[model samples]
Target: MAPFEPAALPELLPLFYRRLFPHGPYGRWLGYGGVVKNYFQLREFSFTLRDDIYVRFQSFSSPQELERELQKLNPYKIDIGAVYSHRPQEKELVFDIDMTDYDDVRMCCSSADICSKCWTLMTIAVRIIDRALVEDLGVRHRLWVYSGRRGVHCWVCDDVVRKWSPALRAAAVEYLTLVKGGAETVKKVNLSEPIHPFIRRSVGVVEKYFEAYALVGQDILGSPESWEKVLALVPEEHREVLQDEFPKKRDSMQRWELLKGRMERTRRQGTAGKSAPCYADWEIMLQFCFPRLDINVSKGLGHLLKSPFSVHPKTGRISVPLDLQRLEQFDPFAVPTISSLCEELDAAGDDAEQEEGGELEPKRRARGRRAWRPTCGSLSSLWRRWNVHGEESCGGGVTCKETSEASLPPTALFLLRGHCWPQASWCLGTRRLQPNPSAPLNPFPPFGPFLHKKH
Candidate 1:
């Protein structure tokens, strides 16, 4: 009888009902997981209002019984439905709508209280949709009231555009989806100065909305101009209400300014000249620079290197710098190599047995202990040996040193025992000196058909 006051309706209730029956009464209902329904005879459509002002229908005669019944229903668990159109004698047609599109439409107010966060989100949605319809799609769209007892709905029926392809629909959905998580994408687009004209226009609209909302003390929306107009229509006394309804304008501006400053700093530090690095880039860089090291980059370093340092501007070769500072954090030379250590040991001393016992023993033994030895010829084996298992010993208490010494090929042993340089000419079996002056010592011994003496 009070003209069905819109302001009195619970904000979440309309969204709940819409989710339950999106396609109308004819839609197929998907039952809630644990909800139970009971049939009751009702003489009138009774509205049972809770303390939060959320209304529900009940056949119970007393308030105590209604309250008791309400306690059983779980508000978080809700029923969902799909709308299907039935044509007599024709195949049933279903509207395949993406439910994610509704995520942008948030509850602005709960019961009678104003939700600043939700209101801010709703304002952004309104502006985003408005910009998409007017600029991108070039279609006329209008905001409609769902009798205020329900949530507001936007009707996008412009006679010029009837049906859209799936791709086009997906794009529309993506555009709407951006409004939900605030202006993150918008900020990216703005910073990069996107080449797409439509996107640029949308970005401008979003910026304007943010500015206008701040000016009027309202929750920042996606379109500044539209909100200014909305502000003009609101009564003066209600203007003060915005102070409590939205984030402080100075605080919001400070955040935006801080972000912009960081971007500028990135550009100045030559990071923007290379590839646009995200927070993940720094994370990966930190991991690579210090493999086993765990240390937070100083705020000064973070500020200086907001983006990953790149080698080329166009190609953008990204890698952590292997300087002294970074190397100090983690031992870069800790990556062991058997061949290099063997070469070093040979250069330092002539006899392996002598090297193992003398002053050089400690160094050679340490090298032998850390050196990686390959067991299999496969690349997978190499990766497993090098990365998965570090310096895995083949024999008990002997380490890879003993295993490598034992497995040395005959030719390699000849080269080692003869005191012949790895590149010098030498024969394996007789320990005979070869006459050929040009032949280099091959690490593999000649077998059968391959046994040709170098002339």
Candidate 2:
């Protein structure tokens, strides 16, 4: 497209409103050129009557060029939602975040390239909206699109949400911003439980992206086995090569390093401003670095921050510092186990009904009972055993039972409770007596609430 001045809102206001704000009662005017310039120069808008307006601009032209041309007009942050059809006679409010430090070029480039970092931030913004309006408040809404060249416009349609006051919007934004910060903290905390729910959801998506890129990396690396594993993790559309042709040849790590060096050189020499070109060039460089491996560096370290592993501040290496017990709270695997157990219980009921109806019944239950097998002894017993054994073996030469002394004392009778029989047996000796299945697992004293006592 030929360079043309951006349309003046005064002359083109009707057209702008028709095209961009069809349903609004009134629209805000954004003057792009000398009208804005002369307004500042003359300290009044009255002088703008005759100033020549520059309307056409190069899409790729730097913001510096635009700044040089328009002395009075810097890029203004426009909230599309605030635009109206007819000027509301009522008090009007606007929701806008301070954009003082934001660089327009960076913003434009990031949006244009769909930069991973920028994409993450934008997606997080969407998620905040989703969580606040949909999940928290139980408001049902659909996001509408604005085909803004540089940035997205999300139109919130829920009547209840649309009526939200400016103060409410601001509060929601603040809460969302806090959640964003908490998402970042996941990198430091390494404990997933502390992460805000919205952040956890976003991080899960980002992790899947990483896994996809890693698969691509493996494919490029020529490690067929690793590539297959990675491929299996991703969608079929993401796999670029046939399963049989995946590279089997392995190259030395140094060769890959050399290839990366060459790729970096190419990236630097290439037009650095073009995001797509940069991404493409980087991919090419990766291919050269590890012809056999598919390294997805495009997504970058943003994914690493989302993982439940903390990166060391100085070394920049990731480590798992959160205890396993804490990790289980937010773990998807563990959460589903409860539901699976419920399903199993339902199945068991069906089995009981079949038995009563004289239908053939299986010897053992199809649904397995829940159990806990102790992996190690309690702190007290471990300490005592260490004392008895010193640095060497214990003099008694007795086999160390894996049971926790805290759960079952030496003098306590082994009572098989619901599912605790097999689970508790690891800690309790196999010499334990089998009590009636209907009897209480714990009769009294130390057993207390932990075991079932016969009435």
Q: Best candidate per TM-score, number?
A: 1
Question: How well does candidate 2 match the true structure, expressed as C-alpha RMSD?
Answer: 28.4
The C-alpha lDDT values of all candidates are 0.28, 0.27
RMSD of each: 33.3, 28.4
Q: Which number leads on lDDT?
A: 1
Model 1, stretches more than 4 Å misplaced? Answer: 1-120, 141-143, 146-151, 165-168, 179-195, 211-252, 264-455
What is the TM-score (0 to 1) of candidate 2?
0.27
- Candidate 2 lDDT over 328-396, as tens digits, reads 121111111112222333443454455445444343222111111122222222323322222111212
TM-scores of the candidates in the order shown:
0.27, 0.27
Model 1: how far is 253 from its true place, Å? 3.4
Q: What lDDT does model 1 reach?
A: 0.28
Per-residue alpha-carbon lDDT of candidate 1 for residues 135-231, written as tens digits (9 for 90 to 100): 6766542322111111122334232232343345445555443222242321111223323554445445445445333423433232444333333
Q: For residue 101, give model 1's deviation from the true position in Å.
A: 10
